[model samples]
Target: MARAVELATVLGSDRVDQALGLAATAGRFADDDLVSILEHIAASKPVGEIVRADEAHSVQSGTIVWQALGQQPTAARESTGD
Candidate 1:
């Protein structure tokens, strides 16, 4: 919950609004349920894109989220035995 609040603070309303607009445009999510809309957006983006976006947009929040998610290793990391 704290991480969510931090991310919300970092992203602000404008960025969120823009993302929602984009989601609506790309996935016709305007009338969809929240879960369906989120699923559509997640399906549309590659994992790397999602990770990079989180890191680039809000490093601290991203770190918190990644940690909370158990900081799973990426494919490249596993391949290289990092």
Candidate 2:
């Protein structure tokens, strides 16, 4: 709860606080769900771009998002470093 509150504070947005409140109450969630949530929050790009045949753009966008989350890479940090 404290960690969620702290993260909500850092985010400094009512939307984030509300979402965190929900998550904290609901307890843990799956990694893919979390990633999907993050993608929504960051508005990285449309799902089409992510699933496009051009692997380079998809890889680049993924890299940008992974780095934003303090991760090395999805494959490297799939366990969430927990």
Candidate 3:
């Protein structure tokens, strides 16, 4: 289609080709689907980025402590001899 050629001209064939493949796989065939997919592809940053505590925040305990959560809420509960 003429619009695909126009998009390819403006955005480059490789990007368009890749987006087209993704669109086909996702079953998106509406008129604006290409542009929508391209915009989503471009706007790749998560709408909200959550910085994990282990990433560099010194005040938060790191992930290793999280692994201990599976055992129970606390060892103190088990040690109570119930």
Which candidate leads the pack in lDDT? Answer: 3
Model 3: colliding residue pairs: none
* Candidate 2 wrongly placed segments (more than 4 Å): 21-39, 44-82
- List the candidates' TM-scores in order: 0.25, 0.28, 0.53
Tens digit per residue, CA lDDT, model 3, 48-72: 7776665566785557877776575
Residue pairs clashing in model 1 are none
Ten-residue region with minimum lDDT total, candidate 1: 28-37
lDDT of 1 by residue, 1-82 (tens): 3433453477565544545666667764443433354455446765355444454576353354556475556875688884
**TM-score of model number 2:** 0.28
lDDT of 1 at 2: 46
* Candidate 3 wrongly placed segments (more than 4 Å): 45-82
Report the Cα RMSD per candidate.
18.2, 19.1, 6.9
Number of backbone-clashing residue pairs for each candidate, in the order shown: 0, 0, 0
Candidate 2: tens digits of C-alpha lDDT, residues 1-82: 4544554567655646545545566674554444345446667554356454575555454555554575476767777777
Better structure of 1 and 3 per TM-score? 3
Count residue pairs with overlapping backbones in model 2. Answer: 0
